[model samples]
Target: MAEGDAGSDQRQNEEIEAMAAIYGEEWCVIDDCAKIFCIRISDDIDDPKWTLCLQVMLPNEYPGTAPPIYQLNAPWLQGQERADLSNSLEEIYIQNIGESILYLWVEKIRDVLIQKSQMTEPGPDVKKKTEEEDIECEDDLILACQPENPVKALDFDVSENRTIEIEELPPIDHGIPITDRRSTFQAHLAPVVCPKQVKMVLAKLYENKKIASATHNIYAYRIYCEDKQTFLQDCEDDGETAAGGRLLHLMEILNVKNVMVVVSRWYGGILLGPDRFKHINNCARNILVEKNYTSSPEESSKTLGKNKKCSWSDGLSENPGVSICSYVLK
Candidate 1:
């Protein structure tokens, strides 16, 4: 190897090590040989409303003659926001030519996310007024307008119904989403002690407009039945053929019980072939392990904090990051 190439490689290695230390669990090395890795960044570490995965590919000549290639994976990211983020990343590369710029690029994206969150923050007064208005509208109709303006009262009822639907969603645990070629897969996990609870969880999830819009919401559940000495188990593919069965099979292999796992896939208008199944299973497995549903030590180690290997066949790619498949449209 030439001296310059060796130096570039050394710098890249140092940068990756530093990032791993700095980000800790949020950093994931996907493919070591390809110099492919990703970092999950949130506006707030404690409680983040906006989170995105930054996948970076360092070419052999990185930091010497070539800039690191990157992709921002977030279903919410689209249109001008996506373009602007891409432009900002390019600008960082241009400004820091011949230097390891991953850290800078990450901070830049975080800054943008911070700005986004701030801009989208609802005002206290507006929120309070909306809640008050909902109650007041209902009361006024019930007291005064029961005879007249029935249509207006119906409209108000519909609005309140939507709000109730959103609030009905149970506390759900979400797995870090995996993305490739714009297609994304994320797992939603919820505790369910019975078959009725499983149905409730799925119904609540669909209440969220973004999740309801996913191309596929493959799900599986296994509830332990002490009386019968058998398990109440079921699965649904939602649209993706056989995906539900595969997800349920994974749950059974892990020996997880009283849990419902839903893997939502938002197809990016591309056929991923068999690779799609890999992502779906990975998403399911990651969440099951993270939630302490599995007892295997080896399986536990493969959660978001460790290096999650991506399969490379037919030139397909997979990148994992810390995300809940909420699909929050901005």
Candidate 2:
């Protein structure tokens, strides 16, 4: 082998050894030929059911000019979900070309799996049934829960008075953070019943130095007034151009009410152009879906389809990309 080739191979071996040390012997392995190895990643730290079994093969010019080869396996995931994740891994590799990305790939896949677990319906597996069977099951369940006397249910007696009260909305603090090409996006969601609550939440975000330093802190809020019997909506771009209005419009179309969404972006020194807007909206939409602010998961999927078509319009100007970075608050 040429001198340069020998040096490259030596460096690759060192990297492999370091990875093995860091991930432990069980999680990382090197093949006999020193050209390929496997890394096993689990969704949970202890007793994980979902896992990504990744095999990486280093090319001759790896970490200098060419990227390594990767094969991924996750039996629980299939079809478009698997394909999309594979593509995302490739994109991460391409973004960090000429550098070590095995660790990043592992972490990214773990995060994706965690998100998938949260979104999946929790229950024991049931055998597939025909439409008639489903209908019969639904009928049986309804009959079991219903009261025999429907008319007496609505009769309220003055002697035995009862009142129903609305449940208070819960506080939300978890925010999901996404990064692309050094640019960072964070989405925060909270349930707001009044306009005053919206102002307080926005104030709190701005009060934090990390959030305040962001290049843009675009926000949108929708509140339904019980006394007034009307919807109140507003948005602010925070110097992100038309981002605020777009976010507000998104909430309107999704039929989301009594919620506030804030997306903060920190400049990462690269211009993403129109893709920045896409990322911002995606960040917000993901939080909405994760928090169950929208309807059922099936309906949320359909709403996303409609969102893509209407997100871009003549309202916003096409400007050169700006630097952006962000962090999520707990």
Note the residue pairs that clash in candidate 2: 266-324, 266-325, 267-323, 267-324, 267-325, 268-323, 268-324
Query: What's model 2's TM-score?
Result: 0.40
TM-score for each of the candidates: 0.40, 0.40
Whole-model Cα lDDT of every candidate shown, in order: 0.64, 0.60
Backbone-clash count (model 2):
7
lDDT of 2 by residue, 179-286 (tens): 677677777777887555565556555555677688898998877555654456778898988788667755644557778998888788999886677667767776
Best by lDDT: 1
Error of 1 at 15 (Å): 38
Candidate 2: worst-modelled 10 consecutive residues by lDDT: 134-143
Task: Give candidate 1's whole-model lDDT.
Answer: 0.64
Q: List the residue pairs that clash in candidate 1.
A: none
Candidate 2 C-alpha error for residue 165, in Å:
12
